[model samples]
Target: MIRTTATLLLLALPLAFTRPAAAQETPIAYTVAFPNAVHHEARIQVTFAQLPAGPLQVRMSRSSPGRYALHEFAKNVYDVQATDSKGNALSVNKPDPYGWDVTGHDGTVVFTYTLFGDRTDGTYAGIDKRHAHLNMPATLAFARGLEQRPAEVKFELPAGWQVASQLRPDATKGTWYAPNMQYLMDSPTSLGPQQTRSWQEQDRTIEMQVLHDGTEAELDSYVGLTKKVVKEAAAVFGELPEYDFGRYTFIANYLPQTSGDGMEHRNSTSLTSSRPLRGPAALDNLGTVSHEFFHSWNVERIRPQDLEPFDFERANMSSNLWFAEGFTQYYGELLLRRAGVYTDAEYCTEALSGIVDAMLTMPGPKRYSPVYMSQQAPFVDAAAAIDPNNRSNTYLSYYYIGAGNALALDLQLRQNYKTDLDTYMRAVWQQHGKTQRNYAPAQPYTLRDLQRVLGEVAKDTAFAGQFFRQHIMGHELHKYDALLAPAGLLVRPARPGQSTLAARLQYNPDSTATLGTTLLGSPLYVAGLDREDVLLKVEGQKPISAKEMQKRLAAHKPGDVVPIEYRTRNGVRTAQVTLQQDNTLEVVPMPNATRKQLAFRKAWLAGKAK
Candidate 1:
């Protein structure tokens, strides 16, 4: 049986009972009220009934789903209290920072707390007079042992407000349903006076609910653009996943108070941005829309085994995010081009070239493979730390590394294997992602599974093995120039003759330059200069700004060793640093191309919305 919300509720009822079976069948219910919303607070109550004859451990999740970092969500909860079925106060023990242990409950426990939230984004909860945006883990507390119990939530919304969420709507007004803890935690809710637009595609409802400070007409135009993006993304996968609720939703919050972020969930996506629905900002916002919707097929369902049962207690790391997130990152922009939202030049210069440049120029990918980089997501993926990190030298985002791999593999597949990435993705979908078992993938994939699928798609195990070893596991980049030639694209240096120190500098008011992390093998690093070192002079001349520094470097040619003076924590230092030619690369169309090249380029970039 497919665990739809209704079916799961029915199945869950039989497991709980102490009073009459009818009364005992009551699911775990929560009631949320926002009387103190002006103060960015919400009063939340959760009732666990038909207990198993022991103390119930009620706790707040330390981590949210899709977010790899531990957010310590319990810190925001205060004024915690618990009561029994007769409303008598129970003993609540603060055994740890994350949770409370409640004893002396009369077969039922009602746990309540005041949650304070102010940030509006995908990972945390935001509450105000304007709206209450709730990412479940950041808002709700759950009983430890009752993970399998069905759950229902009721929102006591203020007047003139409505609720929008992926949770199943119940017959009772203001209530929504989830099958189990996994589904409940994955569901994010927005309660506000928001504008909504919905359409049907292949008999499945696709809805866009936006909480924005814009007119209805502007939203209508944005929705039109969004529809095109939706069409292009669906074309890549051939069809949308069969949504668990027979619907898919895009819950967007674009307001002055919102922070920019995109989070993917089963059957929906949370898109929050401070940009409005107008002009270039609108297009930029749609970029996130394209990315997050594509994730509906990739990360949300095309699951990685390491993240299969997402642990809410600690950080979740994976070795397959390159394919999961990186491939999606590649398609996010490609689909925009396919939808005609971006011209060929715009895509090549802005999106495609950026990926190539980071992979080729950045030292991180040269040192760490995509698999190793993917494992670092817990620390780098929005993780907070007071200590400085050497990420510039040791790390490149898996998003970029994976996208680079996707680009190389796509070009190689087209040239040698007589196929494309779309075909391989569909094959992976058929093998690993298409089957749904409750709230997650029935068959989540591993690194080995991905390699196997690639072998199947290419019809050659040897090529797949070599590609995975060189790119995915081993730190080796592809010959991009050769791979892009068939499509009449050239990977060439952006500034070939320009000389550089290759270190980012923050010009100070005191006529000194503070160096950021100097890249490995750069002139600054070779001269024993690192981050926070103040550059007193270069070539015996003080350069006050970045432009001035560039002008000074322009006077000399590459390989010219010039005297430099800098100050470090110990004392002043003097060294001779050799200037290096700029190695930044870009992807551009060849001026003169054969008809075959044009055709190949068109075949690759043209819309495939049928």
Candidate 2:
């Protein structure tokens, strides 16, 4: 049965009852309680074994692991009070935006603060009567220089509520242990009544803990689908990552009250969405499961130097997130298709339209390369508030470009070298990720490291160097038409001779409209039409909608001049634009393919060397 919020809360036991600490290990202990979930507030108590010699500074993270943005988590904390082991009050000062400095604390220091969490996603914490979704970095505070210190966390849950996390269980009930602060902050905990399913994958355990409005039967089916994905994904790398804790957990909250997010960690992933476990929502959210699970190898342990020992004081920027996140995006879809969750037609449609078509048609890559997009992640990756920029015209998600590169590289290897991307990725895993090596910031894989691995896989350094130069370091997009020809696939225009408006259209019911991207080199660009230009009219009549504007433009052939009116900072204006044919592409199978084409296609899809 799906447990209701009131039922979950009724399960909570009183705070007067305390659990015993781990045997002789008095690690930094944290107690979290949700007394009034309706207020979206949580009471957190932190106890340290001893105080530092000087002023003790405790801080909330500015950035969390696996995220690139600076969240400034301290903003949500209130009613903070610090005291000694005797409960004597201590003086606390807010010296900075991210931390508090406590002084005059003898021997032991215990602090309590109320944290507000209204959003339920991978990056932030959220607590209500129904459940508590904890992203440790956002909900817990760590001492300034004791990141290596062991810690224990205990939840004062509503009666009958259970907990799901990646952290190992301690001796006490409702308590977990982390070897150090890094692990503590990296471990996210989900609390509530949940339907759980578990299976053993060889030596490692795979578990799913789900809290949703859906039924247990739905959750059971989803778990079965998840097992398929895990198997297929493991086949790509030829092995599973060393699950650090000997278990990998998928902690998901699909309640209507939760916000949507998917985040990866060393041994687990947190997936929260408003979507359910059945129907189309299942497919929609499973991609996140596949993607984050793949990350157990890619970013979690394979590691990026800049992101290592993740910075909590500021944004964690990395130029390799293009490869880190983007390649995973490619595998997310591919693995799903391989697992039979997606049919061939479904796979082809999404790849051609969503990833390929979007990347090829967007003007952002024409201006900025994939590496630049990866660098821009600090501002773009989930950094959505207070943004006023016209990013549509200037930025393409790194995931799109990265996935496109993966496609191009995969095809090129198959065509020229009788190899594929799987071989290259596996080689990387064996060398960098397999050793369970904790990468140092100074030792992260550079572009050269990637090129070297590709060269090794293809046995052709020249091709690897050139591919990296053109697609990774430079902005040259692949011509997929040539890349897919050998695999019995053809790229063609979705609509023949259809004229493009060039500028992306956002229209209101009142006929007011705004432009999103006036793509460069298109008719709109040649005609001086730009982003943020409010569409006042077209040929003296206000555009009723995007379809109306498209219909009007479709009436003319290429080279036909049309009058366009728009508003900008300079006020009303008019321009004569020459209509151009839309170049949006789609991939279609060659019904009558030659034997060689079919052979190449089979080898590519089978992930086998030619």
Best by lDDT: 1
Off by over 4 Å in 2: 1-25, 171-173, 385-387, 437-444, 606-610
Q: Tens digits of per-residue lDDT for model 2 on 518-548?
A: 6668887788877778888888899888777
The C-alpha lDDT values of all candidates are 0.85, 0.79
Against the hidden true structure, what lDDT does model 1 obtain? 0.85
Candidate 1 on 141-193: residue-level lDDT in tens? 99876776678999998998888899999975558988788888888888899
Q: List the residue pairs that clash in candidate 1.
A: none
Clashes of each: 0, 5
Misplaced by over 4 Å in model 1 are 1-25
Model 2 per-residue lDDT at 26: 61
